[model samples]
Target: MTTSSSSSATHGRSPAGLDVSASFATTLHTPEHIRIAEELGFKRAWLYDTPQQSPDVWMTLALAAERTHRIGLGPGVLVPALRHPMVNASGAAALERLAPGRVAVAFGTGYTGRRAMGQQPVSWAYMTRYVTAFRALLRGETVEWEGSPMRMLHTPEYPRGAPDTIPVYIAAIGPKGTAIAESLGDGVFIMGIDGVSEEVTKKFESVVYGTAGSVLGDGEDLGSERLRTAAGPALAQLFHISYELGGEEAVKALPGGLEWLAVVQETPEAERHLAVHHGHLLRLNDADTAAWNAGGNTLVGHTLTGTAGDVLARVKDLAAQGVTEITYQPAGDIRRELEAFADAVGLRR
Candidate 1:
């Protein structure tokens, strides 16, 4: 199973707040999942940015807004390099208009998946620069830098200076990426597999979430603590879930497959993802292993897991760390998953 550095982090390093995170499904049923997240009391719902299988990011988040209230939403993460900052700015502003204070956008530097679209991975500095500029433009401010070319066909009706600046978060993992998040983002959505420790993440979370305010300025609810605690555990658990089941099948769905098992066991210092692939492979079978692994700590860290008590425990733990919001994306069961979480958390009515 996958786990986040937040959980792996030591108590000394754990942050002051914790927020929830979730993702949009790629299928037609996604809207339904959004509704379920709302009903389940998950405060944040995320729409993903996969080129091949994912749905339109802004449209999906907009669809979600129409269906629910009291829940904040945004794209799980759009690649900063793929679309120009202007387009990203416009889309984010549009989303803010739709959900107002409930809107926040997260970006990721190009990942393995973005390459499918002929997009190259972006440097951390560039990603930071692009996102900072995008946030500025979204707030209805003028920016000096020129970003890549982009266009948004379905723009949100401008609120005409309704504080159009929606919070912009980045989905980053690893030390270099985390440093970027701490430096450049309002918050971060961390990803993980079994080997990565929650303690490692929580230590980072404590620092970032704690400093979100001084860095971003004002809006505690919109500050760093409102950011996520970490990612990975939930996805690992998903591998152990019902539909996917926990076996060799699930292992193959992840990155390494058999290669992970052979390498990770042999090499501790081997590439982390390679180790994760192996750990996942060892923990599960191929049929159940997810071929795709992407999310803003939403699918893996906060949603889809053990008992209601287990979820409550996880949520509370993060909350204690100062996470004021928890965006829930129901990647698991729409009805049962939400129902169980709502029952356990008592946040859902």
Candidate 2:
């Protein structure tokens, strides 16, 4: 399991939950999907930001805000390097006005957003500045930037800020990012439970889960073909991130770590992002599929696929592990997956 530690020291009350949420890449579906999620009783809706392939993140979220009520909405994890803090804060502020007290934002060191552009993830120092400045500006506080003080512009006509304060969640993988969240953020967003150390649960106010899930047929293997078809690309992306963040050892920790790493390594550095693009939910090549098959599923990196009861049990198991919020993103027909998973989880329209 992925583990993260939260700091005992926090600036304010932390946000906590034991609820379900829906996540999607902009191209996976549309804003209406968020409404469907809300109808099905999901507590939150998260949108992905992949500038090269997906639709505009903020407008999509705005559409979600205008169409839905109650369910929290925000980027699943906005890459700090892609946009300036002021720009990010302005978009969030506008969305908050449309849906006050119901919007949350998460920040991350660019992965898809950066890699797609043939760049590497930004420095942790840059990520910290982006998040810290974004938070301060959202609160209408002045923060020094580029050798000058900057604050998100506020006007009576627009009120570009959250209701009281916009809740912030930082996407963390290793110790450094988690430590940053523990020290500065209101919550932590993680890809798997393995990253969540026992120490983290006690420190952060909220923990948001990110996972690839699909319904399973009877007697499916841990590395079932159906799951591979639906969520294989996502699983591939998981290993890709592991290798990118922590190198070979980290990728080895994944279900199909070594084999997949080999296939990924075979690709040219300029084309590396393609190996994990398109939400990494599907469109894998034969070699990649073979590598994935060679590596069986594991505790921390398996797709959520099973009978309704089985899926529910898995979700509960995660909740028991201090997962305050689970963001489910299926890899196939968005509506069908959402409806099925929603039903399986006992969520009703």
Instruction: Write the residue-wise lDDT of candidate 1 on 125-178 in tens digits.
Output: 888788777766655566767544333333354343343456656666667787
TM-score to true structure, per model: 0.60, 0.82
Candidate-wise lDDT, in order: 0.49, 0.72
Alpha carbon lDDT of residue 193, candidate 2?
29
TM-score of 2: 0.82
In angstroms, how far off is 293's CA in candidate 1? 19
lDDT of 2 at 313: 84
What's model 1's TM-score? 0.60
Candidate 1 residue 135 Cα shift, in angstroms, is 1.7
Candidate 2 residue runs with Cα over 4 Å from true position: 1-17, 161-163, 218-226, 242-267, 276-279, 282-301
- The C-alpha RMSD of each candidate to the native structure, in angstroms, is 12.9, 6.7
Candidate with top TM-score is: 2
